[model samples]
Target: MITISGLTKVYESRGRQVTALDGVDLHVREGEVFGVIGQSGAGKSSLIRCVNLLERPTSGTVVVDGVDLTALAGKGRRAGKDLRRARSSIGMVFQHFNLLSSRTVQDNIELPLEILGVSGAERSRRALELLDLVGLADKAKAYPGQLSGGQKQRVGIARALAGEPKVLLSDEATSALDPETTRSILQLLRDLNRQLGLTVLLITHEMDVVKTICDSAALMEKGRVVETGTVGELLATPGSRLATELFPVGGAATGPDRTVIDVTFHGETATQPVISQLSRTYNIDISILGAAMDTVGGRQIGRMRIELPGRYEENVVPVGFLREQGLQIEIVEPQDEARGAAEGEQAEARDARQDESQIDKQDAAPAATAPALVKDGAR
Candidate 1:
């Protein structure tokens, strides 16, 4: 298992300190494909860099398999044998297929073993076996320049595996490829994850990457992890900006009397025809707005948006019951009237909180023979 706690990174640029990671806490289980996803500059690159000690964190602890890696080399940047040993067990791949254009595929794949000083004959034999494993035995003699993008990635994956690594770090290994090539590469990663029982950590900006390959993932925004959940759990979470971004199906404008809802079901619940149950149980009509069925990590998952008649409060019981049935239920905004009421309620709540805060501050005023507010603001 990999455990990270209070991970932080800060850099001085133009005489100002900028924090790239803000106390990130995460756990990646052994033998599982985990993903870190975000828009550009989300510090995904920084987090993964910290994992391999490619970029040592400014603060926090990285414990892998019960070893505190930050203490490597007794606090100096020079890693002792412990750090080198740990690093040899962790392999990394890149967005670009960082292959030597001049070398044959077999030679490229054998580079890591060679670096470890394996015997020449053993390196060649092991390289062939890896080629066969990746279904690239036919391309053993081909140079990277002669292969397609997907084939080159296969080589990259093969080379990263040569050290018999327990962990595989894939950093945007598919974003540069076309869709079909990306799909093939993802399948290969999944197969390798299963075959080697390799704990894989991949970072990507595309949501589809997480939906396709990762069993569990975290969504990052501006260097902060906004949310982390199983892909299915994320899809089922209501008003999830990440899920909505992942599955952006079309929903049209409807009449004021019509209500819209987004529903999701997983595993057995997906096949239960719960909408029909809701209809039969409540005698209310439902119009299927849009839906899609897809599997993630081989788990059946489905999502749909439906239009329900009348106001939200009128169908509250039926909706609440659906929630109890373990279906993911999201009420799409009602018409302007309902929207206005919701906004009004939220504004009133905000006003109430502000009023309470003001009252509390007033109550505290007499007790303050106090420090100046400006200078003591942080307190």
Candidate 2:
């Protein structure tokens, strides 16, 4: 429900201009979790902040559900009544939780309602419902200092939903948690997406987060979006950098005679025994160098690097056979010299075949030269 066009963000630090976002264009559909991934300085943080107008764009439009937030706030850093009213429908969860030290979990969740002039009874009731929604019902009275990192994030999520926003912007929301906790938080987000039909736009440096929860993803580099698509689409795309980053297959050294190929398996193909079928059909030994396989969005997706017995020229048919089975194959190396020599040999064989054809034609014709040689013997 969020559409961003030509969005740019620039800041000045120490008299030097820093561009955090550059002509970014993004669309996040309603009721889906979209992820933005990048390294430290790729400006993913700036992109998400601009979605909710937490950071004003240098130019361009930020439209959510047909409302242009950039126009509502005017061209300034301050938040006017119109902007704040618009922001109340958009929830933001920070990496640091951003909870008040003196506030209990319930109080923290109720803070937004309090500022919105909600009645005390209604605020308490909504806070309790949200705490239960985030599975933090028992921690309602617990202070932020008494909660664990994951628990604190749960409080943050609950507080963000306190306004019953149609959109949720998560800025590295699970970056501070442990692996197990991260999975739990991700599952929580997934559940929330299904239950509340909340549209999530999350930015993270972790590939696992995208793999585990995101339905669609964008890869950012140096303030530019280099790649974006559904997880399966990205995996099926040839030479997709995001696919490689998401499913990393290690490289192994191979002898000159061996051919290495990377095969991508998606959907039902991931469960197929295509590798074994190739070995049986070609009677050639196959070695797996590395494999990265996982289930994304309840579907199997994987990449496997394998080595075949002979060079690519000898195994072209076998690779084609694998491709016929709906597997995406990429040759990691090409034996150029060997292929050239083979082509030369084929050319020589073609010349020899032409000479043999001429001799056969001469033999089939009347043998005049044999008759001349036999005359002396007959006399």
Give candidate 1 misplaced runs (Cα > 4 Å): 73-79, 249-253, 334-379
- How high is each candidate's TM-score? 0.83, 0.85
- Scored by Cα lDDT, where does model 2 land? 0.90
Give each model's whole-structure lDDT: 0.85, 0.90
Worst 10 residues of 2 by lDDT: 333-342
Question: Candidate 2, which segments miss by more than 4 Å at Cα?
Answer: 334-379
- Compose the digit string of candidate 2's lDDT tens values, residues 105-210: 9999999999999999999999999988888889889999999999999999999999999999999999999999999999999999999999999999999999
Task: Indicate which candidate wins on lDDT.
Answer: 2
Error of 2 at 297 (Å): 1.5
- Highest TM-score against the true fold, candidate: 2
Counting clashing residue pairs in each candidate, in order, gives 0, 0
Error of 1 at 117 (Å): 2.2
